[model samples]
Target: MKDRYTDFKEDPRFKIANREALIGCGVAVINFIWWFGFAYGLGSKPVDTYTYIFGLPAWFFYSCIVGTVVIIGVVILMVKKGFKDIPLNHEGGDDL
Candidate 1:
C-alpha cells in the first residue's frame, strides 16, 4: 500500500478551490449583514402608513428590491473577475 497523504496546500486546485470558497463566503456575509441591518435594525421602527417608497415600505424597497439588484451586480462582477475556469479533465492526465 502506498501513502496517499500529501501536502494539499501546495496543490493549485486546492488553492483555487479555497479562493473560490472564500469569495463565496464573503459575498454571503455581506448579504447577511445588509439584510439583517435593514430587516431588523431599520425596519423595526414604528410603522407609518403616510410614508411610502415606490408604493411600498421604505424598508422593503431598500432591503428587497434595491438590495437584490446590488447583490446580483456584485455576484456578476465577482464571477467575471475573481474566478478562473479549471478544466474538468486533461488529455493524458488524471481527471479533475
Candidate 2:
C-alpha cells in the first residue's frame, strides 16, 4: 500500500474529509465519556461552574446529549463516505 500522507493530499476532498474525521473522532470520544458517565453516575448530573467550560448545569447536560447525537452522526458519515476507499494496514497481511 501507499503512504497515507503522500497520497491523501492528492484528493481535494482530503482536507474537508480530514477535518470532518477529526471532529467525528472527537465527538465519538465525548459521546463515549457521556455514556460512561451516564451509566456510571446514574442520573447524577454534571455541574456547571468555573470548572465547567460551557455555562450552566442545563447547558452541560444538553450538550452531552447533543454531543452524543452529533458524534454518532459524524461517525456514520465518515465510515460511510470518507473512508470507503482507504485500505487497512495490517501486520503479516492476514492475521488482522
lDDT of each: 0.78, 0.58
lDDT of 2 at 69: 76
State how far residue 63 of model 2 sits from its true place (Å). Answer: 12
Best by lDDT: 1
Give per-residue CA lDDT, model 1, range 39-92, as digits (tens): 666677788633568798877777788889989988998899988787545433
Best by TM-score: 1
Candidate 1 lDDT for residue 43? 79
User: Which run of 10 residues does model 1 get worst, by summed lDDT?
Assistant: 1-10
lDDT of 2 at 60: 46
- What's the TM-score of every candidate structure? 0.78, 0.36
| Steric clashes per prediction | 0, 0
- Runs off by more than 4 Å, candidate 2: 1-9, 43-96
Output the TM-score of candidate 2.
0.36
